[model samples]
Target: INDTFGYQNYFGIIPIFDKENLLGTLVIELKSQQNDYNSRFPELLIEGKLKSDEDFRDYSFAFYKDNKLYSQSGKFTYPMVNTNEFEGVSNNVVFTSEDTNNVSYSHAIRKYDNSKLIVITKEKMPYVVRLATLSFFFLVFILFGIVIYILLWIAKNLADSNAGWFNINRYLMINANKILYKTRIQFSVVLSVVATLLIVGWTTFSYIKEEYLKQQKDSIREKIRKVQLSYEKQILNLGLRVDDTGELQFNQFADVNAAYLNLYDINGKLLLTSLRKMYDYGILEKRMGPVAFINLSKLQRSEFLNPSEKIGTFTYAAAYAPIRNAQNQTVAYIGLPYYANEADYEAKIGLFINTLINIYALVFVLIGVLAVFLANQITSPLTFIQENIKRTKLGQKNQPIVWHRQDEIGLLIKEYNKMIAALEVSATKLARSERESAWREMAKQVAHEIKNPLTPLK
Candidate 1:
């Protein structure tokens, strides 16, 4: 069946038979609403439908009827289906270029005995879109991470910082002897370094991801050139000859075709613009010199610019071209907007930053715990020995500091106990000797007193 356009439709035709004689031809139109409906055959087929996720504009739909080609359908709505990829398929098929006429993201196929129809919905997401998505998430993560980091930093500072605390050195004096307090301080210092490294590592990862997503440059540039070249005739023939009013035949038709249209006079003053989403339009107000602000050749170039300072801001990669007149003189420069989807780039950056921040947060937490355990292991023994020394100084019964390890600390405790024993013994000897000397002096004094009494009696 042909539509009003007189195009042959993919009509599945089945012949009605009276015993063996042909009665009439039963025709059913096969159609695909989404992807290019492609199949082959002409007559003797049933009506069917196509299921796919690919866009309909990409490929046209077709079906086979008795091995003869018939009308094509944009939507699969005919019969006679091959079920190999779909008859037993549990779910919709992910389209690969290897199995499709063109690349498709996802497609649906249903089998009816020996024949199947394809329906595609949409194409795979372009690199710019994906990059922008990741960048956005990364940027968000970075910002969120910064906020969290600042909060944690403030809390930690309030808790651990020993600087300018109270009227006196009260905090230091209070925590001076507590083993856990000293350990925690030391652990915090170590963990801070580890956390810094992790965060820097995360930042580095985001930068690398952003760089990687700056892909398809040659292809993208080629596409830009082709688009510009396609519109070159109109620009030169009519758009350029007319003034900024766009009164000429060609200039009048350009408002819709151009993606990012900006007209600049030879003197570098902006004359007209078709772009409405212009945030950096202020640059147009500023008089431009012979060289453009971001262009490299001072002739034809494109570059990325972040006009705004806001977080998750857009970084647009815009292209510039020269509009020439009949005399081949550079009459005006037209700047074309390459990527209409500026948010994707921002999103990609954001995502990259955000992912790293989250990872760094997790790593910071893990490192903090490790730092505490490590600090405790290194400080606990020294703290115990200190306690014993304090006891000894306070004239309290000091228990021997015992340690299992044959390290330097163990030897120190052993020698310290020996010194204590030696001092005790020497003090006892000095006391005994002083008592004997006192006794001898008393006896001599008694003898002297008795002799004086005898002399007085005589």
Candidate 2:
């Protein structure tokens, strides 16, 4: 028999002896350990003999006769044979002897297969498996978030680079055409060389920058991995617990050590956030939007609404990752901002762009100036030769061409002078022939007149 007091109680009794003897009884008590009369056993028997003795040979046995015994205690008692007399069942019940006077005993049975005894202390507790699963999902989500972020970053960078290159190419082409418009064959080689060099330099610069960015991204990914490892370790070290309502709660595993961390439900509802809020003009929410939440796959495939519209500005670079569940579905996103802020990046890039613009502007100015100078140098002497030929065509035969350099233009001027001199000599010969003809005419007339007079006399 067994009884409990105060909180709760339970009792049980087992007959140690067979039906014929009815000698021994085993009892168990629940909570109270007190040994008052209300908690004492009624009687004990051994081998058909009513044993009233209090002290048995063994401390657990209340009475013993011919290797049989009896014992009594609070609300429960048991009598059994000593191990020296009965070896089989004696070895099993020997350890149940109580030393304290009013101690209660709870019975426990061990199975033969050596399975563990699981004690469910807090019955009203939530399943820790759920919490573990949630944690794993959270980590997965973070990993996905990181991946998506990186992919989107790559896509955006590619787009920006493509756009910039396109614009630069168009500008180059326009400038090249403008330079070619002067039709100066001498400057064509220099312009072509300059264009080739600019293209090569830009290409080399882009390659180096891309390689450097790739290395930086790799380094950042490694750092993020280390940080995640440390964070997970810390979360594990801080134990998980269950609340009164069977809910698993973890007070420590909330935050993440990323530049940007956000939590969202499977339905894409905002659950928690750690992002800066900025407002300007009439826009109350500056940085908060669906676009800010980086879905890597979507971002990679998504076309920008208006890429020409600048989104603030950036330099260095940004990366992203998606938070996924154990099932490999993305739940949230994490972004790692560049070491340099947007403002700083913008300022630096702006300065670089401005410097490039100034350089390009200066180059264009220099090109224009050079084109003008070359056109002037090429056309000046030709214009001079043309005007001189026009004057000579208008019968200004005495006019002499003043040529400084002894080149083709000088040779042309010398030929023109020789042709003018030949024209003048032909004119003097014609004038002499006319004068001789007139004199002949006069002589003939005078002879005719004198002949007329002589003819009449003859």
For each candidate, C-alpha RMSD in Å?
14.4, 35.6
lDDT (tens digit, per residue) of candidate 2 on 215-295: 656765665455444433433554222332211122123233434432333343434333322122332233323554434
Best by lDDT: 1
> What tens-digit string does per-residue lDDT give for candidate 1 at 1-458?
54412134476879999999999999898644322222221111213443232224444444433323334555333334433332323244434332244433444432222323333333465564555556556656776999998778556667765644462356557766674665667657766776677777877877776564555344445545654565566766545544545633334444355444555666667665553224343423423333353352353444322222221343345445555566766666655444433444555666666665555555554565677777777777788877877777422344566677798888988898886676666767877899999999999999999777865567
Alpha-carbon shift of residue 30 in model 1 (angstroms)? 16
| Segments in model 2 whose C-alpha atoms lie over 4 Å from true places | 1-226, 236-258, 263-273, 276-349, 383-411, 453-458
TM-score of each: 0.42, 0.35
Write down the lDDT that model 2 would get: 0.46
Q: After superposition, how far is residue 126 of candidate 2 from its true place, in Å?
A: 70
